[model samples]
Target chain A: MLIRKPADIPPSEITPRSTYVERRRFLGKLASVGGVGGVSGMSGMSGVGALAMAAMSWRPGDAVAEVGAGSLGALVKSAHSTNETPNSLHDISHYNNFYEFGVDKAAPAAQAHTLVTRPWTVRVEGLVKKPRQIAIEDILKLAPLEERIYRLRCVEGWSMVIPWVGFPLERLIRWAEPLSDAKFVEFVSLHDPKQMPGQLFPVLRWPYVEGLRLDEAMHPLALLAVGLYGDILPKQNGAPLRIVVPWKYGFKSGKSIVALRFVAQQPVTSWMRAAPSEYGFYSNVNPDVDHPRWSQARERRIGEFGKRKTLPFNGYGEQVAGLYAGMDLRKQF
Target chain B: MWAGRVAKPSAAWLARIKVALFLACLLPTVLLALGVYQDRLGPNPIEVVTRGTGEWTLRLLLITLTVTPLCRSSGWKWLMRMRRMLGLFAFYYALLHLGSYLWLDQFFDWGAIGRDILKRPFITVGVAAFMLLVPLAATSNQAMVRRLGGRRWLRLHRSVYLIAILAVTHFWWLVKRDITEPVVYASILAVLLGMRLPLHRWGQARTQAAAKGRARVTGPAWPRNP
Candidate 1:
């Protein structure tokens, strides 16, 4: 009897950057030369023989770029960030939590690349001295981009440690120069129905909106990430530019942002509007404050099997706990 | 009496159908095992197992609901014999779904599980639905049905409709955005429940008419036509 254990193949290793595209082309030529029998023989007549044959027939159309590999900056070490092992680029690319592209966790990974990020402009308005439309390129030049490894905790009980490349959001806020009356900062995402299919349905109000206290926005820990893991941020991971508030839930960090408004009154966010009780405006990662669906006490880190105990403020309690001082997290959550 | 005269299904036929139903019910579990063994459950195996079992549980429940309407409309009275088996299969899948969540997903964290059931609306409804299934599954046999008379047995089983609603609601609220799948399931359940109303009366009338026709054809001859 031939006993064969299925080989554990890391997708990142199998399909790295441009290599996967080249391999697909090579496989296509090979398949043309010889069909199923050749595939079987090449795969050593293993249990995965059929898969090898299927792989040969697979085209390289919709070729996904492997992001988060640029060595533009030295790795960042922050007291707030944990030393936990980061999830692989492949897992980060494929296993997404972005709902703009689609509801399924994997949907954004597959669909978000179609989104246009280049030639993007953001309107900085509301309670500012100069309300200007700044190009994304100019936004990148607003401050020198640095590497910052942060742990992102999703409200859905999953977390990921990502090495992001961006400057402190405060720099941009400082540049915008909010007036004294500016109490809250509202962020609006791109609202193209044709590109983001999820927006077509009434699952959520379009132009996915999120907000933060003006003070929270100006916090040094708040980041407007342009890239991840030393490379240009993948479209799925919110390319061009996106907010990265490590202390809050992943949804709080709006993606492909198009507008920033400094408002007097607190803004109602997309999720907050959709289900007020379930998602609060201040979606701070509090393990004690469970979501209406699941416990936040523990979170499954991407690429890992076992779950780790969730930290208050996603392990940035020292930095962000002060922002919510004297406030009841249970009610806010 | 019409019951004895209707001709009970042969023991061998019953045995064969039971075996077939058993194997058919086992198919999903087998495929799930094969999938796990093959590492085909995508990135999150626990999630795949959890959702897969939950979906199967709902599907089997719907299938069990279909059996009554199917038998009534088609006049395949013998189909009634399979309803208990189908119901048990549904219970079995529900058990697997719960087990997958408890063991695989939660790692048997009883306190957390308890908290989730109390806190989460979806989990609360799902737990209620599964709990309601327990008594019905336990009393599925003839002895227990006889122990608690037909009316009480029927009243207990009628909770299946409530369970179906809770199960559907459980699925509906869990999803972040896409409601298409839950809506489809809810529609199927609605049709199934709808059949039990006016359709039930129509089916009963048709069934009685068919039985009377059979009675006339196969003779009782006692008070015939008098």
Candidate 2:
């Protein structure tokens, strides 16, 4: 392990209340400085290229300084601290990492424009008292977007600090009132290969699926993001709706969502079904549980120059840490 | 080849066709290299270039292999003249594709690069294809041909069949999804192999039947005088 000294940073350390107002102020400045620039300009694309090239190496805490506490907001909630929410999760319901439309990380930002997010409805059925179709617009009106900058980790071992905008997922589940039989919440994405080229892959079937334990789904850290970067959710980023589970690998927080089903048994996930030995539920980023192939100890924090130290529960241990206090993460993994 | 060198050159039309065929074999490689240099190889240029060079390498090899049957069947002996050039082009792109992976992905760090070549299944197959190409490339010249003689030269270059198979396997393993491209290359290779079997048989049968009928009549002198 490489030890880093925070004293290396030239500025005063941030502590106490890291509030929404402060995040907004910082976000505004970061938009001008840190953003690759709005997707509209060619300079912005070059900016992405330039960053990808320069970021081959890194200095510690560069992301925290640039993007702010990133996943700290949602993690703080997971940490069960009411005082701080993530500042980077500016608009969470939408910003996503779907690459089916194209290969560019930013492609989803534009390619998702081809998708129709309206006139949308979700069939919340299976072991639920309220097995009904709910208009997405009505669902949006259920609660206003709030900020939760969650630590996002990918199976590929890279990560990003995203400030997502949405209400706690538990809020809606409580209002819907699942019966005692409901044990899992399975999510389904739009599966058309014509729309999602990832489906055409003989490697893995399309219409990606994800699931979580009902109790885990209700955990305060789980969110239904509505927007990002202070804008309505971009279509490519699962516009209109998506889930954010702050502590797990990114795939568990599925994208381009079309359905959410409450099931009694644990649902089979596509990645797990494709390669069972490699992926597992409770895919919490436990540094001790190495993936079949890679080390989970360190991750490339995207939007930052180099790799960062991975924390227990992605640095959210103060709250949800005790939830797994006695459990063996390696077994669950 | 010793006696053939003393014979007059083939017709003018044959020479022009040989030149045209060489240009055709070279054009895609030149275009692909241009695409690589300019970073115009397409979105995810590394993956695109990877697939492109690999596919062309297999295709040129198939064409070079087919020259034997095509020349025999069409009775165009001149078709053999273009075979060596096409075989070399296949090697040229195969080397470029392997070099790109080493230079760009591995950054030429011999240790990690060696680990990738040794540890990964796909990389191992790809390296095997490259090693097979080395003998074919070396013997492609006239001096080596004279030294090895035609029979030994043909036997050594038979490694082309195995190289094409290994290249296809390398392609199949690299893709995370959509193996249609690799499957298509595999199908073409299978057909190219099929074209060789009856071809050598039919050519030899024609040569021997002429000699056989004359021998049956007079217990073996020559055919035309009778």
Candidate 3:
């Protein structure tokens, strides 16, 4: 199965923008003939953004460089970006699951869009050999985007399939060059309620921390994401930065992040600290292991709520199950 | 239960009960506020905590009300001062419960929410109890009772009996299966309702008739208090 690469971004097309209205009229005029804009630019097939991105030929070098991880990467070798602009699909991506703003799952999405991401600095600290503040842009420039379509399973019995554009956390951690004492890495989301109104309510601890065991952090499947759905990660989603750990529950994937600390011990996690019995630090999405108050055996797949069956390991169990060998997930969970 | 003050409240008795009631009412609010401030309320704790507090408030309100009738026949008027604060406490928790449902659960999805209010039987009864409490809550004060006329306000607040019954039904329907808690609440409600019956003479008449029938068979006691 061909997975989506991180940069399947519609290069120049503005499908949902106000400018899409004007472009639609122009595309209408073009399609009035024998469809001169070619198959990729056809509005009837791919989204106007995808088509427009396809239509406009970037500089030769830029084209090869940007589209290097093309066609949704390994997930879908042949699938093209559809014209169906379901904002709700994108909406859920932007909206659900961030607690830096509030404990309510959707509050961060509603409140976090106002965050100023530029001029933001991520402090790399703790057991790292070179503890330094790095700009988010500096981190993004390190590796060209790659595609990874991971199944995201939330603790609240919901799941989603997201095509994320990111470098592997392993890649970034290797560069961070932590000392031998580094046994874990913790991530902290920005905690200002002046921009994130939900933080003002004191739902969860302000910074919303998440951590990974050193081995887990260095695991190749762990992703350090900067964007999704072929665009800069929307402000509600996490804006400039976030983490995506497909094997674990979604909370382990911290959002609106600003700090990465390689630590010597198990780091503080947001939900686990909020209620230890209910949310464990090792929040692996296991169907057999039920949350203390709720069941994890079933899940609502957001858009396809009633229809979709929540598969074991969100359908990626074959890829990630080996990570949790002989260990009993229920106990760790 | 103070042996000395049981006969009469005296000067400081009402004041002491007032202090106790005020603290009981204020402490929960303080703890909940601190939990909110310190990020202590776990994810999705609003629903559980809200309902728990409301259940406690309603149970306490009934207990406080029962005190008056308990003391009247049992001569315990010292129970009076705590009733208002307890009733207000019920209203306070009810307000938080409603706010949680509105802001957190519903997210102002007004149309779907309105449909749920109409469609869901438990929600209907819950809303009915909530609506009934509003008038009782508004008329809680002596000033409001004076303004509305004490007798009229008393009649209006009598809706609380109906509210308690609806509350029991709401609790019963909310739990999918295990109803041990609701059954306990229902038993307490039954006792509170039963207490009002003896006050109305229906129960007294039944007891008197029973006593008279017994007297005809076994004769009266040799000595009486009178």
lDDT of each: 0.76, 0.64, 0.64
Give the per-residue Cα lDDT of candidate 1 at A194: 82
Task: Identify the runs in model 1 with alpha carbons over 4 angstroms from their true place.
Answer: A1-80, B1-24, B76-82, B119-121, B141-156, B202-226
TM-score of chain A of 1: 0.78
Clashing pairs for model 1 are A70-A231
Per-prediction TM-score, please? 0.78, 0.65, 0.50
**Candidate order by lDDT, highest to lowest?**
1, 3, 2
Per-residue lDDT of model 1, residues A1-333, tens digit only: 122221323223323334543454444334333322321122234436545554655555423344433655554444334444455566567777777788887899889978998889989899998899889888978888776667888887777777678888988888888899999999999999787877787888989899999889888789998887677888998888899999999999988999999999999999988988789999899888877666788987754456889988888776667788899988877
Q: How many steric clashes does model 2 contain?
A: 19
What tens-digit string does per-residue lDDT give for candidate 3 at A236-285? 77878889888788889988788889989897787777778878888887
Interface quality of candidate 1 as DockQ: 0.18
Per-candidate DockQ versus the true complex? Answer: 0.18, 0.09, 0.02
- In model 3, the runs with Cα more than 4 Å from the true position are A1-89, A103-106, A305-308, B1-226
Per-residue lDDT of model 3, residues B126-217, tens digit only: 88888888988887787887798755776787787888888888888765334667899889888877777656575456558777885332
